[model samples]
Target: MKRFFAKKEITAILFIGILFTLSFFNWRSAYATMKEHTVSYLASAGNKWENLSSFIMDVDNTIHEQVYQKYYYIEGYGYIQELLGKKEINNFEVVKAKDGTLHYTYFTSGPNQVTSLVERMERLKKAATKVGSEVIYVMTPDKYVTGVTEFDKGIPYNYANETADNFLQELEKKEIDTIDFRKLMKEEKEFAPDSFYVSDHHWKVETAFWAFTKFVEVLEDNYGLVFPNKGEYTNLENYNQIVYEDSYIGSMGRKEGKLYSKVEDFTFIYPKFETNFYYYAQNGSRDVKAEGRFEQSLAFTSLLSGKGNIYDATNDKYFTYMNGNPGFVEVNNFNEPDAPKVLFIKDSLMVPVASFFALGCSKVYMIDPRYYSGNIEEVIDEYQFDYIFVSYTPQNLTEEFFPFYKE
Candidate 1:
């Protein structure tokens, strides 16, 4: 009888404990706190769980005075990887060079899916011919090809270079007017040693501007078009160049942390003159007008401002160029309304370049096909562009295809 009573008492205590624990969790999740009222109400169950987990992890993190999630990563997977002497973290492979530079793994594969691309371009070219608009293709090289020459053995398989070369040749055979920027970057690298970042994949501001100059040169030569004098670009005094020291910790640095890799410098280039422009975002039912800037537009500037945290998405120095890519952005330059209207169908690599064109041209219609959901032929019909430039970095080419007919 005594043993039976003891067992019942123990079972009752355990049940009460579980109930208390569950009650506390329910209260914590449903608490009408500021964060809950503002943000948590909109969160999905998965995000709520993540927030709960983050809160629990923050206890130890607070004790150590570290970022909430960094404590767990550093003390958990990082510890295990160090113990095993491994350099790769997830899909990113961290490589160290003799000069203490960091490089990530790169692979080159066969050509991109160009069947849809060719068909779409042909159709667009046909429509463009009705309006007397010409299509131009520009290829931007990968960082592995333009910047880092030294790498760990068997890393960054040299397939991208071959694929880009082959694609350029194919475009030529098809009689498509293409600009192989690899040749331009190779020549620019001779003078601008820091044309590409050691830690990041994007080119430096100097290199981007150089390519823009080359773009004009090609346009003038091939299309018999007049261009601005080279002195406007050749002189650094024409533009304002701001250098933010140690402000960049590229995508590679973010993965491995500052202890493992070196940070890079970022430069912001803006036009010195006061410019007048109008920006329009035409996303299906969302036709909105945005005031333009040499950098980010006025409407979305505050949303993208500030010195973001090391890992924060908006804090990236590259965004100062044109506030990154929006689906469909149109710009009208009041500075020169009579200048030729150009349509740029490109990747994010053309962000800064696109801004430059917007500054010079009377009208510029920028389309990023990857994110765009509108009819391309209709846009060409509406704009009646003088030139259509197709620009993509080598690595991005494989990922983006032209969606010509389908929105």
Candidate 2:
């Protein structure tokens, strides 16, 4: 009985000692994560709880990162999916067509959200009208709605397409000037099968160029702005495509890993003509400039324009057009220094399309509403923009884009 008691005492002592050692080593690290630092542990009850909560969250984040939970958890389940030929991941759902195309299921905004967006646009239109600037909303369609679904079994419903169409209908009732690319892309997809990338959500360089020409045509029809040689400007022979074979794994590919969505082509489109332009870019407080050649407007200009292999990550290819995201990009057409100016408010979907506007206009000021903090009315007044373009892909059609004016 004495021996048993002695054993119990020893076990308790050892357990407490080990815990103390661990706490001693980990306390400093855990303390570093506390958002609030109080000299006394007995501060207020609320303060102590808040600090404790912050520490717990930090510790949880550290554990998940250390274990690589995203990769391991998703990849482990992904491996099982591979064996069973499944298409669903935790937050990711991919539809694999027989033609080796992958379509990602996107969540669409509800009616309340859509109504809020329409109201915001109405406010923006009124503001632009006050400054005498014509507001044109450009809607880039989603990949799922591009009509390339011959092999697609249609397992997952496309919220993005349905919501986009609904939103566009509301905009039309308001009689707002709009450019819908869904119809243009659909008509062209029948002839050119590679309008959109196979594994990615973005449109191909060729597809973007076609869309840009359509944009130019609209400017001519609506604003009476003419590119002296519009036909020659839109001609395919004037541009060069840098196509890398089997070199990209897109956003959806990254989610599913290599097994499901394999590597595909990365085609970079740039002008082979006399490319002379001054490009100014700003991201937050940092301002960057590049001049001579249209390549300057692109992100990783050196790499995509011929410094590195196109076979890097899919983001490298997509970002090659205008980098990931910039607060603003100003393009000046040296050829037409006195031409009309346009203020383009866009998401990454319009990255490739900006250069097209630059070609037709004297100056194109590309502003990303996601990051820009200045007043749109002030921008319209200051820049004296003739046209204001608010562009976004259907997937990105949400209230967040217009949050600046929202209540």
Candidate 3:
């Protein structure tokens, strides 16, 4: 009994000593291993809980589907991530502009955002006047503002409408040349119900044609340049239908992750004009050929729908134009001699509209603030364009416009 007791005591002491030695020497590794084990255990438990919950939810969903309608969790875990994920990482990229203003990568900031934007427009006007170029501020409407989708309900403010109205008011007060597309859109509300695509942020090709008519009208009225009216142009109908119908998801829908109803099938049509174009990227400082042919089957087919650095040659083949870099793009008309050079500062909203301007200008220079970080004043001076147009969506106006202004 004594020997057994002594052995038991010895074993306890040995075990304790071994544990202490391990704690002293391998503490970090042991902690790490323990942490990993705990995480794995928690993750396994979470997954099991999720499976069980999903099984139960599926039963309820099945019953709901049978009786009432579809089962949707408007505020679900996936949706939470979708909503918060973007906001968490929504830090703007800031670059120094030649003017005192800080060029934010995505949108605008600072106190009195509207006034700052007006001031910026004034600066652009002064710069344009200095360079002897006409500045036409083309305000593009936002998809959400047009009331196509209800997802924009959660936005903190009605910045789109407010900023647009304020900017227009300020521009008119200063007698700066501008185009209020919002007013035009309101007047042409007959097609608003079906004018835009539910799944995509862009207006349909038909809408583009409508907007193009208005844009051309503005150009002719303001600048004495006559673009052929719609009656004069050859219209090609039924180019293509939505091939993959419901599979398409827009930037907003993707961000929301709520799985709203799919976009409806619609026909895309374009003018039957021979297109020859080149797109210059401000980032790489290189010029490449752009696609002259229009594809009826692809999504966003009207905009030479290629991704990442594509330039289309004068023929039917599509090529990477400017390597997906944002900034200014210059398109030249090789057919016309001593043609007027026009500079367009635009957002993604202008992509489809480029085709319309391409026919009007001898050289159309487009600058996207999302890309291109060079000196805007320098570019304007160097190009010496006769007409300077700034086209932007309301979303972009609230976000990207003021950053380009001189404080």
- Best by TM-score, which number? 2
Candidate 2's displacement at residue 283, Å, is 1.7
Candidate 3 lDDT, 317-370, residue by residue in tens = 111122222466666655443556887777665666665555555677777776
The RMSD (Cα, Å) of candidate 1 is 8.1
Lowest lDDT 10-residue stretch of candidate 3: 311-320
The TM-score ranking, best first, is 2, 1, 3
lDDT of 2: 0.70
Which candidate number would show the highest lDDT if scored against the true structure?
A: 2
Candidate 2 accuracy as TM-score = 0.76
Q: Write the per-residue lDDT of candidate 1 for residues 274-328, one digit (tens) a residue.
A: 6777887665446757665554451243423345575554566665554566678
TM-score of 1: 0.74
Tens digits of per-residue lDDT for model 2 on 1-407? Answer: 99999999999999999888756655544455443343333464566766777556666765433332344454566567778876555454676665666777634344224777887888878877887788888998677644445433535555676678888888988878788888766565523335677767877777788888887887788777766567767877888878877766666666666665566777777777775778788888788787877765543555444344332343467777766568877878887777778887888778788776577678888888788766765676777787888988777777767764574
Per-residue lDDT value at 140 in model 1: 77
lDDT ranking of the models: 2, 1, 3
Q: Which stretches of candidate 2 lie over 4 Å from their true place?
A: 1-80, 93-99, 106-113, 146-155, 190-193, 297-299, 305-315
Error of 2 at 103 (Å): 2.9
